[model samples]
Target: MESHILAISGGGFSVEEKAFIDEYLLKIPRKQEPLKIGFIATASNDAQGYIDEFYTAFKTEQPSHLTSKDFEALNIQEVVNALDIVYVGGGNTQYMLEIWQKTRFDIVLKNAYQNGVILAGISAGAMCWFETCYSENEEEYEEFKGLGILKGSLCPHYNDEQRRIAFDNWATTQKNNILYTLEDNENLHFKNEKVVAKIRT
Candidate 1:
């Protein structure tokens, strides 16, 4: 089975600026009818507004929002197994990872990926899939370890000078490692841990 990941630095459902990118995401799954997509809003603390936005964006698909509450009430593995795509929203990356780990949703996600689920997201969501990533915390940019599904480091929002500088400094230490720097409108599509396409919107 091939694992697919579309990591967008910015400009997805939340921004609603680049519809084509989202269209590309929706088309990745081979399932044509009843293509189930799960929206993970943990990064935003399950913000209702964000969830509503997702619903508005993919109303035809009838995507389901996977919240922290669902982690306790539902069988995570089963829920993940039912989806063709898992799209994570952006916010606090560290907090999101902590929640995912505590709930063992990370394990479920890994299994889902291995089973050929399309994993895609933007900003904090995009950064969470790599071995390491540059993220902003309390106004300061820093490096943090990621889920390790994808090799190398990812720095989202590279258009920001501070983040770019911080990532550049961190990159110096990670010599020989592949580092992905993405601007607000850029995206990288990976299959089996290899980048197959560089997209701009």
Candidate 2:
């Protein structure tokens, strides 16, 4: 199996972006037909609002995610294996990581990537794939440890996030850091932890 991941800069979801995202998942080589994609809203604590938005943007019906099943009932690995793609929603990265760790999804997701399942997300979703990431936090700014599915740190919503009062000295203050920034409508494509600039859209 090959490893492929995409970390997207989050903005309001749209049809064009949805088309691009779906295209990415469909293009990935898979022996399976009628690929099954799952959405993770752990970042938003599986918020129903975000879940509804995701389905709306993807132009589909809602799917079960922690709401229909006990959190403990979830077999993260099994669920991941049954799917071709896992799309995560944006929210508090730290909180999301904690839940995933407690549920052992941290390990399951790594296995999914190794199994050639496409992992993609935006904002907190995008940032989770790296060693570090920027977040749309309230009150104060904080750093977070990513899944290390890909190389370097990630700063999503670059253009939108810069307007926040807290992201000062963003360009020059952070030195000796491997950080990648993406504005809305842009994407980063990775193969085996190495980024392919040519495929970026």
Candidate 3:
């Protein structure tokens, strides 16, 4: 039985988002088993801290983290066999991708998702999951390839960036693009590969 995926920008879990998850579960065709979570936080030094924060925020619990350099050493088949959600945390995108590719973490993540494990992320976690990302260097713009989880490219911290004008211009030229400059606790939730709603609180 496959599950739905929800990706959010970091700050904290939105109350509305939690309610949305509950509603989402009611609509998933199959009756869900006990929800198991695989927390992926290659970006944060205190990855467990972030995970704990989420658990406390949402009042949900699960076991183990599908994280680390030796993540692939663990049998993916067995780990994902019982997982219903895989929450990836934000970090340096380039570094995360490097580690992901090096340890075949990306492959494991895709497998989990394909097997009905919901996928979610924040910041770099969110940016990398898209097909492409608008990378901000010292000056000028560069398009970087991403995980291809979602079709279009993503630009995080959009409105907040000093180069807002330039970034907006670049995004305008691209056919499939979306920019986000969320405050401390703003997020967009997508369903069926399209942004179904946004929560600002």
Candidate 4:
């Protein structure tokens, strides 16, 4: 099974103008009838407003929210296996990774991806899938190691002045590793670890 990942720099359920991106994600899963979708809001600390927005946006499909709390009672593998697509929300990248590691949800996601589940996200959510990610820390941005599901580095929110400047400066210091950048309305589609398409919505 080929793995599919859609990395969005910004905009999604959180913004009304980018709802098309969410629609685009809905069409990626092979199973069209009664599509099963899961949302991971760990990056936002499982914020209720974000989760509510997801439910509202994806009401057409069978959408469920998966939080750190779920790790305590549900079998992570079983939960992930039931879904056709996993949508991750954006927030603090470092904090999300820490929680995912502690709960081993990161391992479950890798297995799910290998099994042909479509992984999609925006901002920090998008950065989590790459080998290295440029993340915001206080007043500045820095590089942070990711899950390595995809090679090279990812810089989200490229349209933002500060983020673009930070990424540009950081790119100069690195000799290897292709740097993938995405704007607020752009997305990069990766299949089997290779970029297959660039989407704009």
Evaluate all candidate structures by whole-model CA lDDT and list the values in order. Answer: 0.87, 0.68, 0.61, 0.86
Tens digit per residue, CA lDDT, model 2, 15-44: 355566556645665544455667888877
For candidate 1, write residues 1-201 as lDDT tens digits.
888999988888787743888898987876678678899999999999999999888888959988987876567788888798999999999889889889888888899999888999988889899888667787887777789999887888999888888888878898778888999989999999899999998
Query: Model 4 lDDT vs. the true structure?
Result: 0.86
Off by over 4 Å in 4: none
Please give, for residues 48-87, the per-residue lDDT of candidate 4 as tens digits: 9999999888888899988898866567798897788999
Indicate the worst ten consecutive residues by lDDT in candidate 4.
Answer: 23-32
RMSD of each: 1.4, 3.3, 4.2, 1.4
Would you give me the overall lDDT of model 2? Answer: 0.68
Error of 2 at 178 (Å): 1.6
Clashes of each: 0, 0, 0, 0
Write candidate 3's Cα lDDT for 81-120 as tens digits: 5666666677667667777878877777767666766666
lDDT of 2 at 21: 54
* TM-score list, all predictions: 0.95, 0.80, 0.73, 0.95
Candidate 4 Cα deviation (angstroms), residue 165: 1.0
Which of candidates 1 and 4 is the stronger one according to lDDT?
Answer: 1
